[model samples]
Target: MKENIDLFTNLLEKKYGVWNRNKALFGTTPYGKVASDLSISSSQFSKLLYGTATEGMYERTLNNINRLIERQSIEKAYEETQLVINKSKTAYRKRIYFFSILFLGIGLITSYLFDFNHFAFKLSDYEKHPLKSYFYPESSMFFDSPFIYNNAISENCPCSGFEGKWKLSESFKLPLPGMKKPGLYYQAKSADMIIRCSNLFDSYIDKGHGMMGYEHLKSEIWIDTKQEPLVPQYFNPSSKVFTESFKQLNFESDPRFKKIADLAAFNVNMFKIHGDSITRNAELTGRLAIDVNKKLAKKYNIDIGYIVKNVLGDLIKASCKTTFNPFCNPNDLSEGISKISFDCVYTINEENLGLNEGYPYTKSYLFKDQVFSDYLPCECEDN
Candidate 1:
């Protein structure tokens, strides 16, 4: 445990140099605040930058300190990236006025044509034709990163400006009569990430089939940050990434069309999740969860997927293999958090390892790595 800290500190010192690292931690940061909270005379924060241990130290202690340091370190990096992404957005400020007027005009046309009454729009024109509908094959499993699951991630990784481990030392407690005991986390380390994405892609049947559907996939990636790992979450809580994406997506689409203009209005929900405060994420979570439930998908009107077709307009045949964030600390917002009690595993280091040992977090540490096979050729076809 402490040995890991030594390596972490060494990496930090190497990046800034001994003189500068000490000056940054001591001179820039308020000295005794963190140490006081832990009731230690010496700065436990020092363990972040200078302390050494010949072998691993206490498991719980290391996790507590490591998560703290992890947040402090990468939060700084994300702040830096935020700055870069911000400077980039200033260039797009001029285009907003031009699009605003264009949208108003298109909105008038779309509301008149695809009005609320057309909410039940008919495809009679297409159904009467021989092609009937264009069948959009399902999308292949997607990953924001270029590498396959379990591939080692680095600073160079795409879509993830992350590379660190997160550990929650103990279960939480409050000033209540029946507070839960602390949790022991022996297996928190940097490893593969399981990304639980919902409603990222929606597909609808076209022509006369008259059907709409939604789907979700649980993809895996290499390493994920301890702070925040959800790819869509990059926009959540509102970062410069959100604004850039807004502009890029609008600019990419041909907004001159009524369909495109109408979509722009609703698609903003995806953007809204990031714009709204984290506490408001309960709404977004409920919405995304519908992608998994067949009935809920119907109720919510979540039908939206890009359709592919051949020149004659038959749904292009494409092969797809099968596959499988949250808010708060995500741990706090997790289903597992609600189930915890004082007598659960938090009380005894090795108590009944309940259903969700790695709540708000993920898989425990083990020698054997969780693996996923690369996609192989398939004979999938359109029915």
Candidate 2:
């Protein structure tokens, strides 16, 4: 392909010089003039250059080129090619000088209008109106220290490097391309704020994976006294609220996550309730796929199990779009219940979860799986 293109280009340069991709100084492109002479469309001539022309066009163009080469002697062709080369070099030098002057003039004017040290646009303004920096670069020097992070941590947070310059929560309101809305709206001095701003390491408090040593607040708190381990133990499920609520969570009807949920429920309950009795534990663990305490399965129905699975597995899968490491243990289940109730999945921004809008997970196998299909919508129909 390269050889074919090169042969065509070398021949073209010998006859008509380089094909100016931009406008020709006269009227039409050199390629266009040659294409017209050969009775082929400019596009067809281009295709021939890249060896992408149809068989008929390729043959016709080759025949025309052979005749064209034969019409002129090698010495004449060489002399004509030298003239075109000299002209092309002059034009190229003129373009370089023109651009250099244009850029220099623009830079000097920008510096004069808006001092480099004191830009008309503050980082705070850029934080609030992010696009202003790009559109009006003269005003907003967004690359500066404070403005470097378009979306920094909350102003209320002590760890927020920018001292009271910007609010992390405010980023949700801005209509930036890849910016995602926060899961929980943070209010100053509020429980949500305290919960969000307590983190010193990362910008936001991520679900399941928070920085070590930080007392990252969970949505639900464990019951002070342990009751029936099989029963739903977490109290105050509605303590945390999300900016957007989760909908269309078909846990029971969805077989994949349901099976995982049921197994998780059985495992947690069996571990907690029958851990003391080795014989009972082994028997119950074996029957994980089948059932767990038929009397309890019937009594409470699948509600407890569904809740267990929804929080630990379904919600986790939905929120962590990139990675799907679900927790099914009692502690994680309690946190999961909180996540489900507060709609935590939507509260955390997509950026916080390491999601790139340009490269989405909609087509990924994890997204296609029936378990997550309801949570993460796919671009194509499921197989």
Point to the candidate with the largest lDDT: 2
Per residue, candidate 2 scores C-alpha lDDT tens digits across 15-54 of 5666565654112346667887666787887788768966
Q: By TM-score, how accurate is candidate 1?
A: 0.27
Clashing pairs in model 2, backbone N/Cα/C closer than 3 A: 121-139, 182-347, 183-346, 183-347, 183-348, 184-347
- 131-246: candidate 1 lDDT, tens digit per residue: 11221214434424322234332211211111111122232211100112221111111222222212221111111111111111111111111222222532333331333332
- Kindly give the stretch of ten consecutive residues in candidate 2 with the minimal lDDT sum: 275-284
Clashing pairs in 1: 1-56, 133-207, 170-183, 171-183, 217-324, 218-324, 236-274, 331-360
Show how many residue pairs clash in every candidate, following the order shown.
8, 6
Against the hidden reference, what TM-scores do the models get? 0.27, 0.18
For model 1, the stretches where C-alpha displacement exceeds 4 angstroms are 1-58, 72-77, 88-91, 96-371, 374-383
TM-score of 2: 0.18
